[model samples]
Target: MNLKKTLAVTATAIGLGMSIITPAHASTGEENQESPDACMKSQSASVFKYAIYFNSNYGGAYRNVGYPVYDFADERVGGSPQAGTQPLLFCHGGSGNNQGIKNNAASVRNKHSTYYAVTYYNSGYKGSSDWATPNSSRNLSQAYNQNASFNWSSL
Candidate 1:
């Protein structure tokens, strides 16, 4: 083909490609950008629940529980515990129902909002204590591992 015809064809192709691509890119960008109200609404639709992993760093067996879990005695609390194995616990800030987790947790992840999940070494929310900040995760100290009796209010 002549140079003029080839150049014209190339320009037309480029223009057509952009026309096809622009709308798709624009729509996807809009979908990905969520408004504050929309984000809050979607978040509220689901209850605030946190997961407790048996292994460290949020791995191994996991249980997603709502606030106010007093005990871990109920087999249903985090599903049946593994046979012949004491799984370490990991959790963020939330209410601990009572004495069930008195001496069971190994680690914790604090993902609560602007509050710390205070873990008590002894039951009844007493004894030595450790606190985790919101949106943080860590392995508990040896003294606190398998020694969490209660989860008190945020710090």
Candidate 2:
């Protein structure tokens, strides 16, 4: 082909290719990125009626609990006696997403219709604690980020 015709074809092809190539864009779509932990099996069996927040005022990543936790640390997870090696963590997409829930929570919501969720500053459900009434939410006053255990009671 002639130089002009060849140049014209090349230009058109380049233009078309360039047009087809869009600028890469960061994904704005949100998805649950939390990986399944070993204790998830037991978690599914629990009620998960309590929400523990990473920030006061019920903000940031949270973990929902159904049963009592003697220690936020390992050796026990929630109400299960399985002695899980994996630590409990907050849900994804929040301020403390994928972070450990022990001693890191600052707020809580009691979703249980008939039970009170208690957060303790010391492990084994002892020491200063903050309680959230059934179906209530509260910013941890004593426990705050020093929380170490959790339990639900009728009182």
TM per candidate comes to 0.44, 0.64
lDDT of 1: 0.41
Tens-digit per-residue lDDT, 53-73, candidate 1: 444554443333334333333
Q: What is the C-alpha lDDT of each candidate?
A: 0.41, 0.63
Off by over 4 Å in 1: 1-46, 74-102, 142-144
Backbone clash numbers for all candidates listed: 8, 1
- Name the best candidate (by TM-score): 2
What's the lDDT for residue 138 in model 2? 93
Q: What is the C-alpha lDDT profile of model 2 across 1-155, one tens digit per residue?
A: 35675566457535634211111111111111122322243333435567788888877777666555656664342223553344567774569887887879988877778767889999866799898988888999899889887766556
Look at candidate 1 and tell me the lDDT of residue 23: 19
